[model samples]
Target: MTGTAFDLPLEVLRARQNVKWRKYAPDVLPAWVAEMDFSVAYPIRRAIERTVREQDYGYPQRNGQNAELLLAQAFADRMQDRFGWTADPALVQPLADLVQGTFAALWAFADANDGIILQIPAYPPFHSSIAETGRRLVPHRMHSDGSRHTLDTAALEGLVDARTRVILLCNPQNPTGRMFSRAELLEIGRIAIARDLVIVSDEIHADLVYDGRRHIPIASLSPEIAARTVTITSPTKSFNIPGLRCGVMHFGDAALLARFRARVPGHMLGAPGIIGIDATVAAWAESQPWLDRVLVQLHANRARLDAFLAIELPQVKWHQPEATYLGWLDCSALRLPGTAFDFFHNKARIAFSPGEAFDPACKDFVRINFATSTAILDQILDRMATAVRALG
Candidate 1:
């Protein structure tokens, strides 16, 4: 009823058979992944449909400006509107996805043995990329006091030694959903500048911020910070088009941009798919109204979860995320028979992203995806509460 596409009936959503719906059996509710359980924005859908109807699946081509450049322009415009940050379209590099951009940035900037600083409880791909690329992972673990999570700048400063080459930042961080404030980013920026470190900021969740919080690009703070930062972002996550595989990496330094371009082969860093490009353009250029509606639903769902847990499962502690549809529940007090993931899977018949996936030290936690219809979210909470009670 929010005039958002998220009101799609459960049957309609299930029929599509996306990863969010098909990953688990009919009996199990899938709330493990980052994808939203919502309908596509009408503008995005229309763009895709138009492209298909015209059978225009050829390689994307643009005069003067390539597809990526055009996307960058749209991205820059959106950033200016949404976050009050001015970005140059020329600084935007189109990539297949943010993960590829992160890996490429790490590979291009650091050697096999050099260290790359990551905020622990990070997106899992960061861990894999560092290991697979043979780079040392220096974790700056965030401190959580059960109410809120704080960035450990002192710990980060200590971790920055001669071997540290790059710092990866995830704004509106995944799993925990902690959106770093401008002041916090400024402090981190100071550290990076002092150490002359390359900062690859993954702000894919920039648009998903809640509670009147504005997402400030760490690179957008100052000239010195921009000079050392590479921003990896996309319309895919917020617009529900990840499978379309469209993402962009933004830079303010010419030399750093050149290095990334030189190391990553053009073919490997392929152009955005026709569908993705169309969707990206539509999502960025015309889908703000739809996005606003979706956000309203997401915020309401978050509040509902907070209330539900307070009554049904008081032992499960959580800090309401400032952004993102993820609920990082502290299940340590429950003392479940096994890992939170296992107990939820075997007993609760609900699938949640395991805390261990974010950080090894987070075995007692679990990340729940709350971006779903209220009816379904209520069902998930009811089932989880039943499972917890059954444990006793």
Candidate 2:
């Protein structure tokens, strides 16, 4: 873990967790999973180990003698500091994870029968969760001008109906790393308030932004907006601790909070998410120095990826990201004689989550993970380039 970027091993990564690792030879690089190759930071490991040693594996209590409770409050503070949004510990609800948090937000707006609004080319689970939950799937696709991504605010507003109760939003959006601007969030907040729709703001990637762009948590907008907003954040993505299965949900409205608090127990959510909370507290309260350095490395790796794709692999179209560590690549330029989805699957031997998984409009795109070292990214580019030329 304390080696040069090259010391980050593609073989070790490919060998460890990926299913493809056992099937393929050592030459291939793995970038499919969101999990990182780097070892968990010293502080985070210590926190989890301490929890383990203390026999803290029992079900967590919402507010009674629970470390999760303490950590939930810390996560709120961290969100406030990072996004200029204020929240209270008592108002924060810990879920099994962020995706679960989103579902819980959906439950909060049980009145939304027409379905919740999903921005396409989103995290694929949103679509599945919607169908599984029996809500209508209202697709509000993001418009890409070929260079940047913009939400069709008018289109989203049009999707809202009397039966629609909530809009689930991914900020510092997954797959495509575009961070929503303050202006964008304000417009969205205004629409949600006007339509009386609750906003499930999944800021899971809240901490991973580009150099200049700031993450605008929708809850921080104003009292009314915060009232209707359910803000979810965790150290899972930023700190590379997703296996812990911990995340936070914050609501400012007392009546809404009371309803949530009362129902959460019946829904089996009154239990605390101790691992998530402890790791989050350590991450927010102590891991800033490590995070700062990692950001620098990630930025460099991102730039390195962009330059390689632009020069060596010009046949691939990649939208340069303004935030997040993920790269959204448009592979249509390759024109490998079939749909972009199947091309990478069969020919490339590259296991990228297809563009179709994000949104219908992005059938020609692919979500590329660039959260690893420059060396690994270099290998990925090389493999993609070879796949393109060979398949063509």
Candidate 3:
């Protein structure tokens, strides 16, 4: 049970049966996707079954998402109790996914070709969302001092211009799995407020914090800071419900939320996928027991991976993440022949998002998802070790 509560196996998993049922030959460990391998919790399954039996896949009701939103609300209370970080559900709005909400929120405050500040080693989509909209992406690089990664605050301040209007941030960050503490977030929030900049915080992994680390929401740092923050949160990461397409865009600024609504007001809420919502709602409202179990096992898996790297693949360094399941493996020691992404894919047959995707300066680094069964992660590490050995 690995001290995670329910005593599930050290490498327990239940997933990708879809590939088998479809008659496809599988060679990949299938760790690329963010989805977890656990079975859908019982309440969610029951809800979806009832919905399907009633044939209720239809447009979102005009009354807003009070019934469905209740789960997130309850979950917030539960999280506050567990972690001491509280949020007001009144500030939260239902959305399709975090990226869409991020883009929509960015659209509300910035213009085409207007500068958007993004800290390096971020969620890759944050970079793309800015460029795809023709906005200038100003990268505020972070420094990796071998043992730990730290933000370059001076470099960030230097990049700001009158046109630089927004900063996109990831907490319990994607790829690197960093959960910024309250002091760190305060410094960041302080920067935004001083620059009169709006902040877009992608907090999908808020619930997946590991060990004793806490995820301090940038908005909740202070009243002034809160007024300038737009936090995108969901159970998609915690409960492995990304397929659900249900998320919340929390705004401390009513005027800002109104602006976002104006931008997407007439836009369709689209059809609600009953299964996804049920799973998401159940995860937030009633699946705390299951969540505790998952976190417990996750820590064991993380420890095992760390030990393996320390002994078997010392060329690539990794940290024990305080939150999230992604690992940023420092491959600078390997000095591979090409980019980290190409090197890993061509040599290892394992596809990880290249550092270039998140931060171009991080040319020697690669991001891997550790959110899989220990057995599969072991296979990946074995292949990874072999690939690194080939480089030597």
Candidate 4:
């Protein structure tokens, strides 16, 4: 037992009725979504409770120099404290969530029909954002050797054209779990600078890095790199408050910031919920201890998953993620009748994110959420192993 607040009973988790639990049949173990099975942090919970008790549901106030929003100030402070990045509140804008910020940045930086470069095996919504916004997608596939995933710069160069305007970067990436190194980021910076491209970096999983790996925000590399980057991040991923729906977009260039502000309407995009605001402030300010404990549990759960696969499901090929609670499992060797996702859902009663959802070519893979209680994780693996054994 990790003996942490993250360890919750199945009954309690099911009762919450969040999408992670409610989306599947009660019998199916949900290991799909990014949601963590953890209790709300004490400070965050108290902050929300105080707001609810006081009936404080009003517009969020501007609380920093240059008339910056309160969320922006909180986010800036967090960047400084957590990542050693100096984020100016003036350049930050609060959005409903990371997706909103992504879309906004894509719209602000790229023109209609402009080409946008993305690393493949990416988060699903990223593909949709480009499609919905009428931008051309130039996919740069990352090569994986069952251990580390790296981008092919030659392929990246081949994909770019005169129309390319933005490169959507997911650091500590989603399905592949590649926490890009500073050297890697520098190489990307060189490409972006040469091509005059703006980088919209999704660092939502920045805080979840494990195994002594550090997360460096691409914008923190240098003044020039910072100027060309827009960072989209939130406390929701780190603090388990996605339902609150608050995130921020940090701009390093004044001109880019001005363009975004001009494109987005002030009142049309509703302010973040008061509970979310309060929770976010408390989360960034006072919940580091809770986060530390949650990381401990997550790290242990990851090891348990690694051991389970090595012992029982050797053919499955777990990549052993360096960061995030997500596990990218390669089930191609099993050669089930159907895709790995459907096979698991039918045989083991487990719901994993279909790898094809991340990239069309990843039909043999499945992404699992390991940020769960050890007991639950063991149950999931046991069920999976039993299912696989029965097939033989």
Q: Give the higher-TM-score candidate: 1 or 3.
A: 1
TM-scores, all candidates, are: 0.96, 0.90, 0.87, 0.96
Clashing pairs in 4: none
lDDT of 3 by residue, 1-392 (tens): 12322332323432334421123224444445566656656676676688789887674332366355564575467557755656677666767667878777777778998889887777878888898878888877666666657766667778889899898888877777767777778878888889999999888888888776667778777888878888888787787667767777778767766776787662544423556656667777777777777887788788988999999988888877778877888888887778887777777777666777778777788877776656666778888888888766
TM-score of 4: 0.96
Clashes of each: 0, 4, 2, 0
In angstroms, how far off is 107's CA in candidate 2? 2.8
Which regions in candidate 2 have their CA more than 4 angstroms from the true location?
1-7, 18-28, 52-64, 261-267, 270-273, 339-341
Cα lDDT tens digits for candidate 1, 1-392: 33344676777777875787788887788898888888888899998898789887767654555566678888899889888888888878888778988988899889988999999888899998899899999988887876788898878889998989999899989877899988889988999899989999999998998878888999889989999999999987888888999988888677778877788765676667768877898999999999989999999999999999998899999999988888888899998767898889888889999999889988888899998888888889988999999878
**Candidate 1 to truth, TM:** 0.96
lDDT for 166 (candidate 3):
91
Where does model 1 exceed 4 Å of error? Answer: 1-5, 62-65
- State the number of backbone clashes in model 3: 2
Candidate 3 residues lying further than 4 Å off, grouped into runs, are: 1-25, 58-86, 266-272
Better model by lDDT: candidate 3 vs candidate 4: 4
lDDT of 4 by residue, 240-335 (tens): 999998888889878767777787755545557767777888898899999888988888888888888998999898777878889888899998
Q: Tell me which residue pairs clash in candidate 1.
A: none
